[model samples]
Target: MADPQSSQLPEDELTVPRAPLNKMIKELLPNVRVANDARELILNCCTEFIQLVSSEANDICNKQAKKTISPEHALQALDSLGFGDYLQECKSVLEECKTVAAKKRKASTRLENLGIPEEELLRQQQELFEKARQEQAAIEQQEWLQLQAAQAAQAQQQGLHLQPGMQPTAATGGHFQPYQVAEGIPQHGAVPSLNQPSSGAGQLPTESASNQQIPPS
Candidate 1:
């Protein structure tokens, strides 16, 4: 037999592969086929997406003081990201993935509940997982389209006259515009501290002209 260590993949190669990425894109856009360049772009996009999602998930894991990344952390990351409009779709996909994983776990661990044979159970579980993946791809495609439309609409409404080097933000409503404060200027509507004495403090109000005048006047 071949050496088990030789057959094992490196930890760095654990990321999603190209074939599955292409399949996912197809599921998202069934009618719109991607050419070679488009396929490359899709790969790049998927890489970026994975990087962002994983980073966000890592943040969630850190918050919980856990070292392992879990489905709950991933779901939280998806929710926390600026995908508010596509939250429902993302949530559905996450739930479906969880369900498929649960089914596989149950099939493997709970033999008593398996009315069917082991091989048949495994096959069925595999099919369920494939279906869940397809559904998720479709959901992601819809979300992308919605985002593009929103961004376009926002640009049109804003008239795209932004200063040089300043790009229009996505209309996801989570975008923040940076404000620069002049060196000595105070912020608008800032409340002064009550504990600090004002420049005009300790001075009494001046009497009115009529009260200050002599009685003969």
Candidate 2:
């Protein structure tokens, strides 16, 4: 029997061997027996499914500009690529996997900061993982609460800035106050007598010669 804890084979050698897959099928359907050819077909199908899932996961990593495919990417790919019909059924398991992966990453970072040797860190992995998990959860919760508070404050400021008639222009077509011209300024097409051209098209009449009364200068 293969040692379950042994390091996985390199990607190049990671073919889906038939025995384990067949064992799983049997466990699921103990009373049903597959014929030799049918068993081969099932094995092929299993290999194809794995290939599809791996390709989808790799695509997800590429989308995120990541060189390595992580568990989060895999989960997102599974959900987005229509393979997550069973997602609700396995939601708890997937959440636990995410938590574990996050804790591991946090632990590794913390140990590195403390100048712990990589090998020595393994001895206290559990303790470090628990500490990291707590810290990550607390940080995330705090940030979430801060974000909510900031949004609420912004919304309150917006409300205060708005007068009674204020509303989104998109939601309710904007209202325009009557366009009031300044006291001395004319409306759009109005011509003020002071600015009107004199009898000679290109020249202004002398101030004393004009019909209107002029104030003493």
Candidate 3:
């Protein structure tokens, strides 16, 4: 027979569940149970392994861990491991963890920086293409203007059979070879026609002018 006094419960009371830390440690670690900082380290390792298995944190695991283990309790384990102001060794471990974490964060940031963002990279590429098109247009315009100038100069030269010295010399294209005309040829800025007989056609032979002609298409 059960003890009546101990077994009695109020009508509205609910059953309470019990947990023992030592039993929990033994169960969690399998064969390697210890009631000390070693146990805390084992627990930390188990947490890390679980997180690894998660690959990423899951809602269910997070809820469970959050409900079962308070941040204060987790930290107290660290505090026992000689971390922080409580122990000098603890301070070293804390600093080491901080350094490692900082390095990881820096590496992550570098990877992000090296990556090309979709929108911004495309915008920059578009801007570069536009600028190149503008430059090409300007170059084409300049070439067209130069072509017009050359054609005008050639047309003027062909109009009159101007001896080189007869007319005040018009500047020629840099590649235009100057023709030699007699120094004493008729001046007055007007050229005699090529068909017209010269006053002294063959009297004193003058060096004929030569021009570098571009090949016909």
Candidate 4:
């Protein structure tokens, strides 16, 4: 029996080639007619073995620059594989399709490269901040107004007691009155110790108007 270790893939195929174009194209294109045409084109070419895989070729064919590869290169790769015979006209169509798909992918990548939609997000955040600020300002304004009203009420109370008559104060619209000593009363200030009738002592004592002694009235 062949030794398993020695019989494992020979040195040539063992390097683990990525995108093994030759084998991949064969697998990709199964059509014999396409493969035949590709082979014939290659054989008929001039001394320069120009496999049409360059970016220029891709551009000429209008491939979108998504993958590092050109679509023309991809088709050529397919044609080079045994399946070239199957995809003559179809390969061109496939390349065009790939180009369109590539353009979309590239566009998507560009959008992703920019940060996630910050403009809309910032706008929403700004709106929230402004709303909060307006609410806070409104609250502050209300508090200030309330404080002013409270101060006005306190001033009115202080002024009421400081005035001449102890009658019902205008500030309170007579709702509150000073406490009275009697039924007809003046609680404080100089209005009247005069609630009392003018008896012998009640009237103001007056001296004679002229220098001469006046007769008794």
**Model 2: per-residue lDDT, tens digit, 109-160?**
8877999777776868978999999999999999999999999898776553
Q: Considering TM-score, which of the candidate structures 1 and 2 is the better prediction for this target?
A: 1
- By TM-score, who's the top model here? 1
Instruction: Estimate, for each residue in 67-133, the C-alpha lDDT of model 3 and write its tens digit.
Output: 4443344345445444435445645677798899999999889858979676886899899999999
Q: For each candidate in the order shown, give its overall lDDT on alpha carbons.
A: 0.73, 0.73, 0.57, 0.58
Indicate the residue-level lDDT of 170 in model 4: 62
Q: What's model 4's TM-score? A: 0.24
Off by over 4 Å in 1: 1-15, 28-31, 109-217
On the 0 to 100 scale, the lDDT of residue 128 in model 1 is: 100
Off by over 4 Å in 2: 1-14, 95-217
lDDT of 4 by residue, 77-156 (tens): 55655447656776778879889999999988886787669687689889999999999999999999999999989978
Candidate 3's error at 201, in angstroms? 37
TM-score of every candidate relative to the true structure: 0.40, 0.37, 0.24, 0.24
Please give the RMSD to the true structure for each candidate, in Å.
31.2, 23.6, 22.0, 20.2
Q: Tell me the spans in candidate 3 whose CA falls farther than 4 Å from its real position.
A: 1-116, 160-217
Of 1 and 3, the candidate ahead on TM-score is 1
Model 4: weakest 10-residue lDDT segment is: 46-55
Lowest-sum lDDT 10-residue window in model 1 = 1-10
